[model samples]
Target: MVKQKSLTNDNTTKVEFNNSVQTIDKSICDDVNDTVIANGMHLRHTMLTLNSFRFTTQLLRSLLMGFILLTSLNTKQLAQSSNLFNRNTRPSIECLKNDRFYRDPNRPVHKIWTNIECSKYFLCLDGDVFEFKCSEGLLFDVVRQICDFKQNVDNCDITADDAVNFENFDLYTQILFSPNNRNPNGCPIKGTFFVSHQYTNYQFVQKLWNDGHEISVHSVTHRGPEIWWSKNATIEDWFDEMVGQANILNRFANIRMEDIRGMRVPFLRIGWNRQFLMMKEFGFVYDASMVAPFSNPPLWPYTLDFKMPHTCTGQNCPSRSYPGIWEIVINQLEVGDFTCGMIDSCPSQLNGDDVYRMLSHNFKRHYLSNRAPFGLYFHATWFNNNNYLEAFLRFMDDLQKLSDVYFVTQQQVIQWMRRPKITPHLNTFDPWGCKPRQWESPEVACSIPNTCKLRSRVLQQDRYLYTCNECPTQYPWIRNEFGLD
Candidate 1:
């Protein structure tokens, strides 16, 4: 047996062997039979042997030529099949050597990102680029470079069946409130607060904690040039912001440090892989700062195993996988008639009615979609406006009337996603409704007294000084740093 090698159109070389053992046996048998018959007879066998030998020789030659032609045809067929397979099955960008460019030629090589929508691939071979489209209804996703459905492009390893369970009959809503500045009264009028250190009043934060509202850290400074600051911040910086915030609350506010489970970047500017690594190291469960408009029904809480399907709208988005760290994406909001991702960026001049309409529209987007948890992500600034405040309060009141809706925290929503169960009714879900709890101090007196004002001479002070307005007259027990009576 002899092996033959052939190159296919796809630039792959395949090895084949000549399988003509039967042909060779038949040729040898015919020659031996002709020789034996010639030996049995003398005179007549001599001439007959000559004719027989000639016929046998010609037959062997013909068989040899036929086998050669057969081998050639088989080689050609194998090559053709290889080419067909290469063409029909989409090859990833990896098939093309040094091919960094996507479909667009204008964008820089580094800037062009692959998504689930990639259906075609350009093979850069031999100093020429050849384009190959994926087989019908599939797109060539740049991240993975394989042809897949648009919905499956995120590469989260989620199945279509995982999108929604009609039998479940429930949906979720989570509030991720970024408290950019502290409230003077220390009590959040609405939603959970991501308190900044500048205005942090532990007593008020404790009230929020006791009320079952989530308390997440939003850096100490909540500094300017948000993206640059977050992107450049290190693990030490995050520790000071989050762990430090926890320490302040524990020492003064009496809030447990272990209770803080999540965090959001100050400006939704992801700190890339480093931030997630920091979260995983510090025992944090999730981060809700990511914006994912590319996701259709919005992505559920997924670990950092594969490339996220959503567009990385914010700076320094995570590029590598960080196991066990979950991302609670910020779904875009549907403003009155227009859709916007950020609440602050929603169409301006929206009165209370328009705000209510926008919230309703956004609520439906999640309700009708995969039932992924909807997020009401906003800063406290939005609530400062009377119209916006009234509209939000009204919306919540209206939302509570609906049986399926749940206004929970990010941590609570993620808990359900991890251990999901189908129920006949929405109320059956745990953490759906709240029960009353005892407060350390009465709600009316949650804030410090009017006579005692918060004063901090330095920026890095851990606790605020409760300075007596009328010196020794008010708060007679309190003393200054110098211990003056």
Candidate 2:
């Protein structure tokens, strides 16, 4: 097995090694299978999807400690069968890994002591709302109740199946929806925010994206792929479907590159063609177009051969939901993007209980494995599920419980997937753009608009993104360091 180590000097480089890390070296995988069978940790029906892992230092340290302690305990009482049973089958557990108490920014870091005696870390299926919890753990649900029994946004109902629930032991997760598209003046908008009504929408997304919650890019109008990707479509259709989106996004979010970070194929077109690779050529980091193993369709990402972020010519990492990018030969689990369907893409038949069950399954899969990224993919239109926004809020509360895991933006993870084999900091600055000159006199490289858009976050800043006359629906970049972008 090959392993990578992150070393920092003048640069950060990932060096591959032979058996340097957690060793499970058997090309045939027969040894691992045998060991699993012998140990009785065999696969169960519920053991399904897996999230991709970064193998962080914490994980490595925990594994090392567990190994060292197991070795010491075993050798300390060698020769006695009773001792072996006592050591390996202790009635207790090992100390937690890199576990830190969550604290408020204004407060002190208080120690959160825990003795996991009866701590059952399981995904709980409430009658209607589901959440993650460890029995006897703190109750950490209801960060903000966005929905009520009426399924209203901020509706104050709290009726029979209205409230979302999660035990205190879990963490709050971030959720962001790549917006849909629109046709303006009979032209498809491109490179802009799809939903262009309110600044609050953009502000919310900006905050979540900054917080490491994912904020992916959907199509400009979210036109079904038939119109967007079809070969039979005319130039107008292409523009309306493709460039239109780019232009709109450019106007809204103002993303300069124009290519969106991720997208779900309209009508699941790519699921049949498996052409998501085509998107990479345009600079998309990844696509959330597929489903996962526990998904309604139930496909395994391990079967896909993809390992990195990709363009049209290359393959990409398999999502936990829909599968097949990974080499069908090699197995690496990928977490798929779950979604909220305010529109018709997926059926909205799941009761609150059903939805909660699905989410519980998502977490349970991660808990069973070494833990990886799980994308709670959805659409802003999902807010339509109920008249009020309580359901979505409830969903958010439940999803946030996996604090130990990272909820990254589509771009961040994709950039990581594009993780270079050479080394980081090679350029010191990104190779894509001009270097900033704070001390040097600022030059007016481009023309500013005569009238800036009302949504410009940069007005408070140095007035950087907004032109005097131009108003981008959203900036080319995400909110700059100060939300000005």
Candidate 3:
């Protein structure tokens, strides 16, 4: 006689014949045809009449084959679905070859290009391909080459659900220049200069500060092998590089230490936590070395209280929190197809009209959207190009026509961010308004600026020191910032 065991709650079926029991897990055979289950039942019933062992063996083998076949088919379907998804997401090798930045050979080869969606990017390593996706609400920034806020990624179609809706906000523009070498030509047409001590004209720096343009530190040496700042620089190295320049500025330029509130690292290569720790330890309020992604509603200058909202494309970006020190992001400007971190690096082939259009297009991206501060970072050499200079002037002239657009300094931008006000209140904004220049000492204009030729401790070479104040005994390099021989 044959008897059927009750199915367990787990959906396991048991069939018994002549003191032998065979268990079939319905979970495995759930997708198997109903005929397969019915045939098994019929074999068990026939066992009662025929009482044969061979028939029962055949029934178990047939059921096992069905489970294997169904599992194989399901696995094949899943593989096809996975392949389809990869085909859609992965960028073609041809696409990478065509990318101007990718083909340049100057950029890092590993993270060369982004997929069309901008939500993911491809990594090429040793003939193998790997893919990475940004976190939720972020997109790949092709310019800065990092995962950034959705609004900051150009060509990214991803919608930011949590984006702050800024309405009727006035546009504030900040122009910053990091002048590494000294020239008789004082300030450029517009913008503040973050002067390095190497070849800087202290008198000219003082004049710029007095003229109400911001004077921030670049570095004492501004030494090259630019990668050193991001890779090998220790906390002490940053202090000497930045604070050393501040000392020189204060002693020679007569600019107060307290007034030198900002700095831009040489080559925009940040030293991650070491850099920020140095800034926080000292009194520096901001650093403008970090680059923001190119987006319509651009990223605003932000403090380091929380984890960075954008990707750290600077390589060794800070992992820990730095509460008060602000990051004045170098929001990139979009040119024809590519983007540039600094205005000068944009297409030099562009005519005056092309330059104007490029500037206007990038400016409107900020003006029409969240009104984050539009930054035009440049070096003094950029203005040497007549085309760029003319176009830039035209662009600024057009911007001046707008009642709401205000050209402020980096310090003023931070102040506004601290106590934000609407467009109506901007005209009367105290921070944006200039304060009277309170000189600590009588202004001493060296009729004949003292030009001292001193031997550099680090470079071990004769360096020219130009300043309104008395020249140092030795060339002020990194470690010997005071130039005390």
Candidate 4:
């Protein structure tokens, strides 16, 4: 029988056949047939071993190629991951350029800067400098450069702007009540009272504050020749009256000093330059003494950077600019076709029906036009009469009946003016409109099982008309004070 041996070279396998005595042919069929016949198992074993080695060599080659490809992939993944980490961990840069351009280097922030031209302001918010554009119809007043009513801007076509769509907007209303009267017995009165040295019902003011009603300063001493609020008063005089009033409210009414953001001139007569300067210095955000809406459609609240908009009907409107201080103009109440700011200034005394018509008409003006804020400006004396009181109540109830109508405070109105929510995208704006509030119950304030005798009377002392009343003094309802016998 022949014996066979296998040899391996660097790249190939070779098979040799031989006998015990002499070499034979390399073909297994010729030289190894005897071995296959005599020792079949050995021949079978050699053949099987050769086949297994060949298969194993092919598998190892495949595995080596796979390992090289996997290593290349892992290195690329590591490099890509390093780049991603660097991008996410890098420092942010804030660049403040030019006099009008600024960037906050430590954080992502935007800022507004005033330019040398009063009418042209620059905003550096989105890493770019851009001029502010007013809403349709308004023009930039060069004196102060803020968007203002067209009447104040010379050579501008007021008629060229597109009208605001009321269908897409919500009606915003604010009631401005100047606490000019003091309660006689340190109790909240039901009717009209002026700020006197006699007494202040801190409880009433507290209720107003808690109920979301804005209580603004008229004057600490609301006593008037009406001339004190004219241009004749100095800045010191205006400060003593306006700021003094705020101090009194904060001290006595538990109202935050910063919360009092609005004021009205005594008798609706502005102290002009001095009053505005004092307001800016005293942290007051807006003033409600101006009466320009009588001649034009109501305008949104604007800063006093330019001349007063509309006709400066009140005495000595400020000629100088008070930047950043807002003028909350009193949009006139419409009585039939005529328009007036003061409730009493209407042609004649309005009954409940006239009052309702007047208010509804005035509201339509704002609801129809640019959707400017609607104001119901009045002294407590006007509401003292049952005719006006019931009418005012009806007006308020009617307002509450309408959808998307909010009877908010003046400060709230100013906030909306600054950031208008007129777009259809803001369908949920002013969510607090007529929401039920936890106010003191009428029975608690007025009726307490005969322990308190609620009475109201109209008393005229000198030229002023006021309503006087007596109550339990603990929980008194100022409105119900006069209605009771």
Higher-scoring candidate on TM-score, 2 or 3: 3
Ten-residue region with minimum lDDT total, candidate 2: 160-169
* TM accuracy, model 1: 0.52
Model 2 regions more than 4 Å off:
1-217, 224-240, 258-260, 271-280, 292-349, 370-372, 385-395, 398-403, 415-485
Provide the TM-score for each candidate, comma-separated.
0.52, 0.34, 0.60, 0.48
**What global local distance difference test value does model 3 have?**
0.61
Query: What's the lDDT of the predicted structure labeled candidate 2?
Result: 0.30
Task: Estimate every model's Cα lDDT from 0 to 1.
Answer: 0.50, 0.30, 0.61, 0.47
lDDT by residue for model 3 over 58-117, one digit each (tens)?
444334222221221223232222111121133443233221112212223233233334
Please provide the root mean square deviation of candidate 2 (C-alpha atoms, Å): 28.5
A best-first ranking of the candidates according to their lDDT comes to 3, 1, 4, 2
Please, what are the lDDT tens digits per residue for candidate 4 over residues 248-282?
Answer: 55544556776688887756788867887888888
| Highest lDDT model number | 3
Error in Å for residue 105 of model 1: 58
Ten contiguous residues minimizing lDDT sum, candidate 1 = 160-169
In candidate 3, stretches whose alpha carbon ends up further than 4 angstroms from where it belongs are: 1-190, 442-448
lDDT of 4: 0.47
Ranking by TM-score: 3, 1, 4, 2
Error of 2 at 183 (Å): 36
